[model samples]
Target chain A: MATRGDSAGMNGGGGVLLLLRKDWSIFTLRHRIFVLTVFLMAALQAVVVDEAYFLLGVALAAALAVYVPVIEWYQGTDPMLHSLPVKRGTVVAARHVVTILGMATAGIVWNTTGRILRPILGGGGSDPAFWMTLEGGLTYSLAVAILALLFFPLYFRFGMGRGIAAFAVMTLVLLAVGYGTAQLAAGPAAPGAVGLITPSSVIGSRVDTLLASVGPAATVTVTLAGMAGAFGISIGLSRRWFATREF
Target chain B: MDAVLELRNVCKTYEGFDLRDVSFALPHGYIMGLIGPNGAGKTTLIKMILNLVRPDSGDIRVFGLDAAEQGASVRARIGFVHEQPTFYEGLPAHRVATTVGPFYPAWDEAEFTALAREFGLPLRRKLKTYSHGMRTRFSLAMALAHGAELLLLDEPSSGLDPVFRRDILGRLSAIIAGGNTSVLFSSHLTSDLDRVADYITFLRDGRLEFTLTKDEVLERYALVKGDMSLLTAENRRLFAGIVTGEFGFVALTTNVEQARTALEGQAIVVDRATLEDVVYFTGRTGEGGLRLNGNTR
Candidate 1:
């Protein structure tokens, strides 16, 4: 049964690309009809909503497509995927690429829909300034990518169910901390203590000023660089964790 | 003959179990059955070979290449079927193959289709809808489609009906007839191996009990039954395990000839040991001492 074929059929880059293609094909087809149904429902609702709110549908579709596949992989495909000749990092990288592509496709659909429906909806359909702004686009992309950086490493480490649970726990902890800090500040007992550590107001003001002062191109570059760094670190941690995993 | 797979002093320790310094080589062109009881490190050993579990020490080689160093290349030559076949819940059967097909160099679509058809797998139905037996059949199809040199199957025949089990055993025999593929079948079903396995590797408590050809094992070990008076301390030393009954006593021994010599001129009967006898006796030895009291019930 051992065929006399080359084991190294693909180089490192080609293998990664092949894995990317595989992930894209599987994820898309697996969620194809659902994505289409969601898109149609959004289109039908476009008459009642503005272009900005309508574009949010893309995120919903993309998130559903990506999340469902991740959950399925946790159900059993992780070992099957790991068993393939591809490296663990390569698998993680390919899935990350698929996630990016799904988001990009969703973004394009949103933009195209906005452009076409602007006239009919009597919405600001073709404002080049709003549509072409790098600030909003890059900031949103960075935010999404950062979330992925956090979520994927956990998913790779503990699988989908535990990863989502951990994420929920972390979110709850942060909210509790935020609420406790607000309560402490509102209490007369800690008014001066709160004034001494008003991090949210100071950080928010500084972040707003910094965004305004930075050029669009510079902001985009910086955000991309940060996302890439975080992604690289996440992939490293994931590969290490996967390598030692007993399953 | 060269070994298709070799493990040298391979060791892996989990929270409660330990596979300590396990070593064996499976020669090419033969079916080697890895037999063990529950929690005997059978699945863990298979997982280690597949690089799913890293060994704490030692080496595993497939096709003369190190598993840890050249894992990807080594794995390309091996097809593995886990106890449970896991896939996307809603994905159709064919899509599962398609998604994985491109990763292997010699993936034959026609072969996969033929095998699927032969196995009666529902190509259009989602995997979640398939029965456990059907999923295993599908897993076997995928394993064969890639033209892998070595097949590592872990507990593959546990939850199947008798007809399907026999069919699977028949197919395994046919696969071995080709003289290129070597299978390492892990199972608790000794009867299935008695029919198909050329070699048997028995494990107990994460240790290798014995690794021998089927004929060699049958010729060596035996089941000896006799009166209780025949049960002496010297005779007890010969038994891998012993159990006393009201009628008489029965025990198993690896050195059947020696046992026969020791019990000569007595009302003792030594019969050829089935693989089942060897498994049960050797498998049950570690618990409550070798001198089992009363009925095994």
Candidate 2:
């Protein structure tokens, strides 16, 4: 029963919340199915691989987050969106907030379930299990934030079709570099000692060591800074792109 | 009187068509009917007013504010209904209203709910499930709910049944009776406009043919019916556009008095022209041997 006047005088935070409500309502049956499938897959993987599966689930969820904004952009609903009194930049920014929130929610559920099941499955002790789950969740959130920051601006500037092509090209170039790095790391002269040179192993060792060395506060600070920096850059680019757009 | 809306020398060019130097004004509290055939730039003109498409030149002032410079403020005061109703298909009518209504400062939920009930819109059902008529009604409810002073409708009656069209016109008339509200409806259906429009603006091939009050239009042109043999060279030239038949001759003339005077002895009958006849005659193509000067009647 909220009236129009009630929604007036909304600052950025209030606008983002209103936008989130609208986006949630607009998401259809197909979207629910897609989200459910991702969650189910992640749940099954968690049951099999314990804590590592939770991080994989977050990565997968973050990758899928791109679909929400991309679909909206391609639908060419700007005329309808612009018809409202909301500013164009606010509309663009709100989509990013909604996508990130959705991704975070999925990550929380995945990590929560993994935590509950770790003790029941008798995979590891509670201390290492707790720290591993926390580290995995943070890393997954950070990776997705980086991808969204790099890709969403491109999607906003160019339409979905071209944006997807650009994303694919960028992804392929990164993959090729990753492949070259793997070859150099696996060379005969290199140390093949267990838990030494692999990117995943190195990241896992550093994250656990960091969690142990500094308190959770330090780890959280670094993660918050990285997420904030990514969000800031993406928002800046999105605002610039939207201001010059004809619609 | 202060003009509610004014378009000065507006022009837009597409790949194959061009809207050139189109200009008109609607006084406050008057319903202006934009009458034209298909592809006559009616939608284009409305879009320009809405700032959905920027004009190549000229200025548009809405509610005494420049449209381009103050697009959001101008749009805030205007309500719009497109020919094809588009809404969030996933949301119910009530949710749709909840989502869209908050963006408008003047939106009235009570009014919207009342109108939705009056229009028999199913507030609980998703819009994609609504029939075409129901969707149009929902769109109308949304437009009216915002307490918008100026309503701009583009071909709103195109797909509607006559009964629904009449209901819409009746509701519009009641809305205009409030005295603070005005409407500019573009439609090919002349009968719909005849029922509610106070003024008429005719566009043909993207050019402004004329903009006149409904009474002035009726007075300015006369439909003449007479024998073909009685049609003289000078009188025929006076009739800007004419249709001849075996029974009699029918012609549209701006100076009804002059045509009547010149063809006094030869004429059979002369009657007042309707809005449809005025549009048809004025929209006729080049050089039909009818030279129109100033006011005809």
Candidate 3:
């Protein structure tokens, strides 16, 4: 004899858990083969090129995180999910939590697999390349998480097809800006500086500076605050947008 | 009898259509059939009740709770079967149940398994592999497994076969027999509703044409067939809609007694209108004159 009051709140903690399970099921059920293929490729890349595995893993995480909501929207399951007893805000919250967990797991797997395979591949143990690759995976994941949090509000507001189109336009603009910045960063004499300025190096240097400047505690606090702020804003926007949506 | 669901002056406007001041009530432990032609806003009204789409004005209450403000809580005691019923297409029925079951506090796994078996749904096969009818049946199975006080089904019989439709209706009747669980399903299949619906709500062009007991609906309208001589300007108003051919004319009337009195000795035959006849004629008329299938006279 379960009553309606059992699962009602701003977050609906119980509802969020159920929604996360359901969302995870939907993700795994629909994309198991693609996931297995991604992992298989990561493993093979780890054996041949250790650095490629981390890049591939980070890319896989972002892709999967975006893919779940995109498919849910495209398939028109959002209406069905909303028709259930779950809070609309809880649904959005559950999805964000699941995405973060999934990406974190992907990063961990990449690091662990690369570490295990490096010794077998006859590489120097604990090399700089290996450490940088692992750290690069984290940096890429964090950046993607921030972008994904922003991207989701669009997806929630406009739905899947238009959301993807918006995402594509945003990606193109970011790429254009990045290219222009790199060209500016490297004057006419240094055409290859774009390649010289690897994402890992820039991201790695930024992390080092931030850590050295403010100490570990401040660095961690700032990181958590940024994530929480993005999450809070994204959830608020999505909830408001979703409430007015006509299904 | 308590109203399990009630909509009071519910109104919603779309780009091309509008649900205008619609209202109805389904008493507890009874089946209410929402009947209308395609694009007549049966689905729209249901969506408003479910809060999938908000009403432009008015209120919907389910089990005495405001539907919009308490949407999540209201939905907890309700089960919905969508028209198309999409799911994780790659997962089997059992797996889907497993994933979705915990959302409902009173979900009964054993009952779900029993219903799945009873519906002849292949538990191991993926939903993508199920036929349209099977998918609908699966939706019905899911709707019944939870201890839902009310079930809202949008065209539950559209993709089902005749036998399955009858079976589903029978099962719904059986559910009502237990003294709980009201059902509100929208469909063009009036015969299925006639078989089991205790209450009937008719929608025409987003307006509530009528909402009454099935007996009252059957009694409230009549079909009249007569000759051209009886098609007088004064007599025409009595007919809700009429169609004329070479020999004579056929018309529908909401008030049979008045129609008989008006057309006395005019060589007219009045008969009880079936639910289909009421839907067809009332929905197929126009201004200026009587409308043929695609013509006006």
Against the reference, the lDDT scores of all candidates come to 0.73, 0.74, 0.77
lDDT of 3 at A198: 38
Root-mean-square deviation per candidate: 4.9, 6.3, 3.9
Scored against the native two-chain complex, candidate 1 gets a DockQ of 0.39
What's the TM-score of chain B for every model shown? 0.95, 0.91, 0.95
lDDT of 1 by residue, B1-297 (tens): 699999999888878889888989999989999997888888888888888789999899999998877888877778888898786666788987887766777878889999999988889998889999888888889898988899999878877789988998998888889988999999999999999999999888888888899999999888888887787777778888776666567788889878888888888878888888888777433223345456532
Candidate No. with top lDDT: 3
Docking class of 2: acceptable
The candidate that wins on DockQ is 3
lDDT of 2 by residue, B144-253 (tens): 98888999988888777888889899989998999989999998888888889999999988999889998887788888777767666766777767665455566788
lDDT tens digits, residue span B3-91, model 3: 99999999999899998998888999999999988899988887877888899999899999999988888887888898889877767
- Winner by TM-score: 3
Q: Is 2 or 3 the stronger prediction by TM-score?
A: 3
Q: Model 3, which residues run further than 4 Å from truth? A: A1-5, A8-11, A27-30, A39-55, A70-75, A114-127, A130-138, A174-205, A215-217, B286-297
TM-score of candidate 3 against the unseen true structure: 0.87
The TM-scores of all predictions, comma-separated, are 0.84, 0.77, 0.87
- Pairs that collide in candidate 3 are none
- The predicted structure with the larger lDDT, 1 or 2, is 2
Q: Which model, 2 or 3, shows the larger DockQ? A: 3
